[model samples]
Target: MIRPVAVIGAGPFGLSTAAHIKASGIPVRVFGDPMVSWRDHMPAGMLLKSTPAASSIDAPRRGHTLADYCAAAGISRLAGVEDIVPVGTFISYGEWFQRELVPGLERVRVVSVDHRSAGGFEVELESGESFTARAVVVATGLSGLSHLPPELAAAAADGPAPTGPVSHSCQHHDLSRFAGQELIVVGAGQSALETAALAAEAGARVRVVARRRVGFGAPPWRQPRLRPGSPFGRAWSLWALSHYPQPYRYLPARTRHYLVRRVLGPLGAWWLRDRFEGKVRVEEIDRVVGAEALDGAPVLTVRTRAGATGRLVADHVIAATGYRVDIAAMGFLSHGLRTRLAVSRGTPNLGPGYVSSVPGLYFTGLPAAASYGPVMRFVCGTEFASPRLTRHLVAAHG
Candidate 1:
């Protein structure tokens, strides 16, 4: 049996966890290609909804901040309309951060994780190698399955999910693929609006579809009301997101769920009555309820608030519906280990410092999201999650 100090995914959260654990002088083994999903899955030309300062991951060393990297690259630390967080820029920063801080990433995909008899974990990878770690931290972000509405799902199975005709906002890589075709985008969150903009720029007849009319807003996460100046901020202790552990990191998943749905969710959608939609067609209060093959191409059956059904045919369909964290979907969570881990709302339950209810099984990144609010799901969330998680892991082993 191989038991390591820790195991983690290699996105910002995973790398940050490894960095903190390794920095504490503990032996850790982490798996996954660093930033592979971020580099590939996220659409280009999308600006981060949250600005740089509000979305910082924790940095153990003073100079490891994105601000520092920006300074070094002659990029402004401040991200404005002209300069936004490019996936490549953040991907490069993650790589540089890995090289500088978390050098333990194995650049391999973990296939399965099993439980050892002695209260430890066994991690098997795509390379057919195995590692034993006292603790295994699952940080695989966005690698979870992206779900589509029933209509879109049916169309995807019949053929290629619409290309220029329709596409899930999540699966799109190139807007040019929809060039010169009619497109209808679903959702009004940043992804939907941004993808709509991207498609329109590519010469496609683009229309945005949303269940409710959504107006774009500057992600209010940075507003003075949400920041340190507010008493609410002081109570939540989120003002130290870049430097300290999130207070919710230790709270129960149920508590966090309430906080997120009641607090963060409304706040996330409250901004943008008059931003981001520049000449884009937004079909407010519409939903895609069905998809049928119209002469071999997909046609979306649309339902509106008035209960009337209409159709929007495109060459493709892009579902920008957000991802869901089903514990059973994690590629590396073997049946044996998955059974052993505690469950919280269909996810592996985690505690403060990202400790799983199952000993030796910690979670980082998206897996920690329910308990950490929206914080653990973002790149910047790593900054807070790492040091707090590492301190406990290091103390236990070091």
Candidate 2:
């Protein structure tokens, strides 16, 4: 009997990979609610860092691009590089793609995945149902990977909740809750800057604190045209990283990790500058050394580049600190399975076609960024990842 391939997420990576596998005449089962992360975790007025051209969910067949969705849905299609994509619009497009290509997607949660002694895997769902699959692709995206700095984590007495004195930026879906309150947003990246802007526009007193000077991306017209363009930006380096990800794994482990962290380092969108610049107070400091709740309000102790220390108090603190990929955080993978899989800096050590050390196990999306380059960190990477992994599965398991 042939078992279906299990794709453990409904996000861009999982949906695109499952669509490709199904197109190749392979049976696939996709799990998780469609666009749940974008719809639930992201703030209400957030805009995607990716441009309209780079925001499509890849599909095996044609007629499913973001342009197609916008045309069909009567929304004006945005084609210019300066045209920004709203998170809400992207979420709707993803749901549309799921309905069109991967209609059989299961909206249930996968409680655990364990390897069978005889060779496949046992997948247990939250509904108490179990199934076996010949192969498993862990495309869970950034669900369990929200990272909070140690200083801020200690300040949240009851843990980082959306309504608490200290919380990670990923917790809130609406910034209006903080209206008429004081907010101190930590980090210089798009998430922090945008969250501060949104909160200020919502009538909150907003301030931004960063370890370094805040930077914004260059205007699209100012980008150098001598080099070929990639979804990230127009540069020879960005082109190579986005197009030739297969070679990225062969680089030295230190270099690979370094590039993954530094290539797309902290920066804000050019369009967001007007909304953020004068509206919020931005403070450049050495680091946030400590944080604590004082009088039920969050107080952050910071150091200056000149070796001076000071404190900033706010009604609440939002740690816009980004995500960190750690396979161990994936509680669905049994401890035994996690320990057996080889990893580099908490990410799976992937081989050709996104397969991990375990023959039948695979991972993609943010988890693959370390091995496949920074392109895997965005939705457009599905264009390169989906077909390659699908081909590998067909050849190896067929």
lDDT of each: 0.66, 0.92
lDDT of 2 by residue, 56-140 (tens): 8889888999999999899999778988888888999999999999999999999999999998899999999999999999999
TM-score of 1: 0.86
Q: Mind giving the per-residue lDDT tens digits that candidate 1 earns over 1-398?
A: 33466465677787778777776767777777887777777777655655555444466768877777778778757544223466667777788888887775787777777888976777777889876777777777777556666767776664334343345555667778778877777776667777777777787777777776565334335455544531123334445433344566567657776654444332222233334356478776556778766665668788878889888776656677666677888757777767777877766667767777776678777767777766665666765678878877766645
Model 1 worst lDDT window (10 residues): 264-273
lDDT of 2 at 118: 95
Candidates in order, TM-scores: namely 0.86, 0.99
How many clashes (backbone N, Cα, C below 3 Å) per candidate? Answer: 30, 0
* Candidate 1 CA-lDDT value: 0.66
